[model samples]
Target: MRSPVEPKSAGAWRSQIPTGKALVPYLLLAPFGCLFAVFIVAPLVYAFYISLFRDTLVGGRQFAGAANYLRVMSDDKFWAGLGNLFLFGIVQVPVMLGLATLLALVLDRGQLYGEALFRLGLFLPYAVPGVIAALIWGYVYGPVFGPFAQLAEAIDVPAPELLSREAMLFSIANIVTWEFLGYYMIIFYAALKAIPPHLLEAALLDGASRWQFVRYIQLPLLRPMILLAIVFSINGTLQLFNEPYLMRVHAPTVIDSSYTPNLYAYSLTTANQQYNYAAAISFVLGAVIACASYLFILVSGRRRRR
Candidate 1:
């Protein structure tokens, strides 16, 4: 007598196994995906929805379509703000990154005394919140009673007014540079440390000087990190919020409501209560960040491939 065959559908077994395996990853990722949808995607969709309308005082909000976008395109203040940001980026980013790289190199060489203390001290400023750093620098930049002014007086020289309209952007840049130097330095120092010791030994055995070694070996190896830093720095320069916002209290005339794009959006949203237009500005700024970041990553990827 042939026993009834137990159910053994191969397709059923295969389907169940693969489906379960596939679902495990999604299950693990569910929390983050849900959070992103709730926080990031929902807000973006809401902002875009608001950006399509115009708030009216007499009437209820009216649909404006792309009118706000058109207004943004022609906005002189927007362009001026962008010009100021570009100037700040052009002048500050290279200087800050260069100084960070130099410090990282010096630290990586292991020649300096109190290297640990130096690293801690260098990184200390970054631990100070951006708002606090801005406030601290604002006090120091005070024309009469700030520490810098007092020092100048003690030395019998007039103090440079840092928050003057002519110098306000640069003063903000300085504060930003001070805050971020250690962060970039640590990034570069980590990259430097990752270089194989054998390569350094080979360079040394070939009678390469320290400068030559850094130029020929370290710099080439650091192209990726350099590109990374540039992308981050550019994104940061575009945002340009905390320092300017905090310092605006000290120099209201120099730092206006629209000192930068973020500040512009804040002014529109908080001061003018033009929620729709502020959303439009924020949306445009997001587009700019995405485009710029994509371009940088694309170029860097191409260079690496080459």
Candidate 2:
């Protein structure tokens, strides 16, 4: 039989320990909290405040209420940038996710040879900085000097102009695919690793083929990770800027200042000096991203429940 005094002694010890348990958490969180306040929260508040006014270089600032938001509704460039993002989300996200899942499955199979090497090779590109990746790919797409063009000319085959306006978006998508596929593959691979070994053994005992196991068991279990990857990809596509910006510098005629929402906002602030309009656009973009993220969560939750 347990002594009655044992429980009370344990409770007394717990009570004797400093009441500063919460202090540890606050101390650990202080740096990130301060950074969030300075970088994210402050900027967000400033953007909101700026959005409510119209800045004048010559005259004084004037309160515009929701006029800036209303202006966004009619902005042709804003719609175009959104349309471009929509196209990218539709095309790029599925392809990248699919490829990542396939690679993860292949690598997860124990019988595969050189799995580590293959995994490392696939993930290596993601380690390269985005700006550097863009620059390298941009040079590869260069007409007179790029390796592709040189190869095509060597074989007396016509090289398509990859930097043409019609092909530039696809060109950018290709770069993103190359850079991120490996990184996302690692994510899917980790998810695959988390599945209980007993679950796989049960499926095998039930006479499930590899295809059946993957289709019914593996994919269903991976749904949450897939949903997360899709959300990340959508956000990334909407925030596309660096690749196009670098490509524009390399191939001046291809990407314009209004190539994407970020670039458009940058031009408004830097070139046009319309900081208020830029702030408004920034808020609208953030709101769009938030709404999309919420819709993704809601839809995914419904599917999960079903």
Off by over 4 Å in 1: 1-24, 298-306
Candidate 1's displacement at residue 227, Å, is 0.5
lDDT of 1 by residue, 1-306 (tens): 138668888776665554667889989999999999999999999999999999898888999999999999999888788888989999999999999999999999999999999888999898999999999889999986898889999999978888889989889999999999999999899999999999999999999998999999999898789888999999999999999999899889888888899999999988899999899999898888889888988887898789
lDDT of 2 by residue, 1-306 (tens): 125454456556555544577569778899999999999999999989989999776878999999999999899999898988888779889999999999999888767888889999999999999999999999999898999999999999998789988888789999999999999999999999999999889999999998999999999888888989999898888899889889988667656777789999999999998988899999899889989988988998897788
Task: Pick the lDDT winner.
Answer: 1
| Residue pairs clashing, model 2 | none
**Residue 168 miss distance in model 1 (angstroms):** 0.9
Off by over 4 Å in 2: 1-28
For candidate 1, the TM-score is: 0.89
**TM-scores vs. true structure, each candidate:** 0.89, 0.89
Please list all clashing residue pairs in model 1, or write none if there are none: none
